[model samples]
Target: METRYNLKSPAVKRLMKEAAELKDPTDHYHAQPLEDNLFEWHFTVRGPPDSDFDGGVYHGRIVLPPEYPMKPPSIILLTANGRFEVGKKICLSISGHHPETWQPSWSIRTALLAIIGFMPTKGEGAIGSLDYTPEERRALAKKSQDFYCEGCGSLMKEALLPVTSGSASSQADKEAKELARQISFKAEVNSSRKSVAEPADLSGFNHLPSSPEHQQESTTLAFQDTTPNEVSENQTNSASSSQEQHNQPASNNTSMSPRQRRAQQRRVPTSTNFNQVQQPRVNTNHMGSNALILLLVLALAALIFRRIYLANEYIFEL
Candidate 1:
């Protein structure tokens, strides 16, 4: 009865809390802009150290579902041109396209960290992976520094970075930075490096079923797609075929008797109750003939099956 957008989703909540607590290389490399609308976020990631993108800052977008951890968020590489296709939706387990493997506990920070750690690996044949010459990747990665996503019109300004004064790092930032380091880097990122799987404990988040009303509404919507006229037409066709069969005569030959042919010429309804169900007259000879043919076909099939069984048995004995 009561429906409201779930802004304070558990996954987003935990992610925000953890993100706020983080500082250091992980935080420095990635910045999750926008805290109000948890469903949409833009992140800047520093390239994997010592790689071609080393010290490079990259920008990307993370679009979360209202269901939060219930569904995976889609990740798009906005700044990097290497290995990943720019602007196109990259297939990832953590994206909404695949819910089975996503985890509710996976924070944006975790996804960002894993994404950076994965860069040194080769781009060979991985989902959401792309391959560009090292030169191109590095160039884009360098440009990613100071890159802004203000031009993406659909995104909210509040969800984007606000102008700040003074040094970006503050005093309390130092302690959070130290804590961020203590968290051990679990290689939950797949070999593909484009997705972040939920921690083991959070894998079942999507298993929760929708509300009863949702199911009912979905069924109703599905039913509406089948028009009443279409169904009636199908039913009428079935009835007509049934009547044709009832009126048919018992002839196995290529030709029909005049009376048999006359009955066949009349279109009949398919109802079982020939009189009350509104069908044309039944032809006894045609019914008998059809029954006889069915019986003969069954007999032939049985004989063939029996012969096959005997042959197989003989071969085994040999």
Candidate 2:
């Protein structure tokens, strides 16, 4: 095998050591590289006892890459294990399906251990997985031993028995628990992260609390600003009232000549005149003085005429 590949290549040497170690430490699974091609191997596995797959002997093929030990191998079950499809690549973290998770430290023995250990668990629905009932799986398991591999040139049961003198059931059960623990730990971590990532709802709050002193200050300033406006309004109302009284029609029109009445009509203030008052006008001060004098004279003359009329009426009655 070393003569075909680079005799001193790290990958080739590593596979040779892994093959030797797999024969001694654990014997429930046995593997041998093809005589012609070192990169391809055939494996035989004994199923765990007291499970649906109890007393089962399964055969499979393992195809390693040129960069193997650096790259993971692809595993295909040739026997009808009922947990996986026959003659198809099995999807596992240690298999070629998850190259990112595979480690160089992991060897053929590690993968075989994981495969048989997970037989009793439910299918992950991954590629090559099956969901046969326990009864169907047990029936298939009983017939797995009769399966023969052309490359290995031996029955499945004959290949697995020579490797193990101890109980295959005890070792498989121990590995199964370890694998379950690893899966549970990962699930718990994911649930905790989801809870922490959830967002909080804050749409219910509209107003926030403020200091009492700040509220008092705001009210005081508002009152101060409005006081001048109220004063200006009162002043405007008083000015309007005075203008109305002055513009009122003289009670006795007989007191004023037609020319004077016409002048009064022309001088009567309009909305236009009120708006113009806001503008700066030339000679307005003198005009205002003349108008005041004319009002006083008319008032005095009306009083005199009223008194004379009353005295005349009094004499006529006598």
Candidate 3:
């Protein structure tokens, strides 16, 4: 094992430490790395108690990735266990199928415990899962003891130690059972949340018509429901009222007193009246421009006259 993998590598060191810790077999489960390959391990776990798989000793393969502890390992069953397919990677929270949930703190022992815990639960059509009947599973459990592995060179019956009472293995079994229960509960909660969220997400679009023709008809009905004649009549009435307002000033001017006429002229100007008022400002600007030009021309003429007078005086002096 030392020559097969780099001793300095973290995965190698971790695996070697784990191998030392699990050197002895327990009644519940036992696993060891292959002599030729440190990354590959064979394991045997007793079926969870009081389930269809009770009394079954199932063999399986564990293929650890190069980045073990940081990544999850793959699990494959070899024995004819009714709960999981043979020679296929089983999907579990601790398996490679769910690396997002796998923690580096979890070890091979935790995985074995989880697997034992999972056997009694419903498969729910998950990959590598089987929904075999209880009778079939019981029969398979009886036959699993006779199953042998060519690679491990051990019978399933002899893979683990005999069950003992009040031992460390029993505690491990309890822990496994609890872990499996928690995992199953979490999965059910997540699935329920997804199912509830799906309808809410699609709720907004439900009121919308599904077919194009129905949508077009609804749009048309919306427009038909609005009274265009009333809107046009309102516009027409507003225009006539405004016309009356404009005519009222001129018509009432003859009857108005001097004070009333002055007050009317001081009122805020309408758009047309405002434009008329701005017209004279443009003429005033033009007048200012003409005045400026005249001042400039006068200044230039005065300068020219002064220059001529100086020239004449110079000629007189000469």
Candidate 4:
């Protein structure tokens, strides 16, 4: 059994570099690759302050492919955020479900920003997306801080510190620009090598050029005040409710009323499956045309036979 993947590969190295450089510029979100696997990462996202997700810290998992930066990752929320289904792959233009839309230059930072912003918007009939009410989202958001993943070995709030002092986008924007610059440089190098028909040796290619000062800043986030006591107390009951709702299979919905079931079904987008519609139309047309031709042939044969019989009878009488 082969258990090793090329962790030293160009794609893997780039991801590792990005992971090290992942600083919470906005302090609203914190993410890092797992200790055991560089391809697997977990992140905590802070809800927008004015939206229903305000004051909420949501936890989720990101599974990057071995060919990452080219292929998008699969993202699943572990926390029971009302906007998305727990432990399910979210359907977003940036997620693995839509690789065609994924740009090789896009990093984890861009995806995180998209997720935070998309949380409060309509579900758009995407998988793992939901249209819960604002009040429901607020309730879930309040409880999200308490939810923990054993894999990360830390509570959502304990691991990621909230930004209390500085401006939100200052640090984040700087990190993003630096990442984009690195990506562009790498792309240019790859294109140049390809044009000359040279075998590219990217083992020594360290585009971002890791800095000691940048490494120190990763651990410098300040913690904000915790959620209210009331929010924590209600979490005990809401925890079970959220878990039950999250774990419950979609197929076991006999308990749901007709209206409720229809509502749930409607959340799933109808596929543009041409086979379901076009096959039936073609079959009906083909059958109708064939039957009409057969009927016409039979009628013509009968008329000819009747005329021949009448002519024979008249000849016999003469």
Best by TM-score: 3
Model-by-model lDDT, in order?
A: 0.55, 0.71, 0.80, 0.69
State the weakest 10-residue window (summed lDDT) of model 4: 217-226
For model 2, the stretches where C-alpha displacement exceeds 4 angstroms are 1-3, 23-27, 162-169, 180-318
The list of candidate 3 runs beyond 4 A from truth reads 1-3, 167-169, 185-318
Better of 1 and 2 by TM-score: 2
Clashing pairs in 4: 25-172
TM-score ranking of the models:
3, 2, 4, 1
Q: What is the lDDT, from 0 to 100, of the residue 155 in candidate 1?
A: 25
Model 4, runs deviating above 4 Å: 1-8, 23-26, 169-318
> Over the stretch 1-318, how does candidate 1's per-residue lDDT look in tens digits?
343334466765655665576433333444453545545676666565457775466667887776766667788877655856677666544455456556777666656664564565565675678877788878876665556576342222222243223355332233333323432222233323424332321333233338886456544444455688875785686677666676555434457654453344344422323334234334568887677567656666765685576567657756
* TM-score, per-candidate, Cα-based: 0.44, 0.54, 0.59, 0.52
Give the backbone clash total of model 4.
Answer: 1
Error of 1 at 136 (Å): 2.3
Which 10-residue window in model 3 sums to the lowest lDDT?
268-277
lDDT of model 4 at residue 283?
50
- Candidate 1 lDDT score relative to the true structure: 0.55
Deviation of model 1 at 270, angstroms: 20
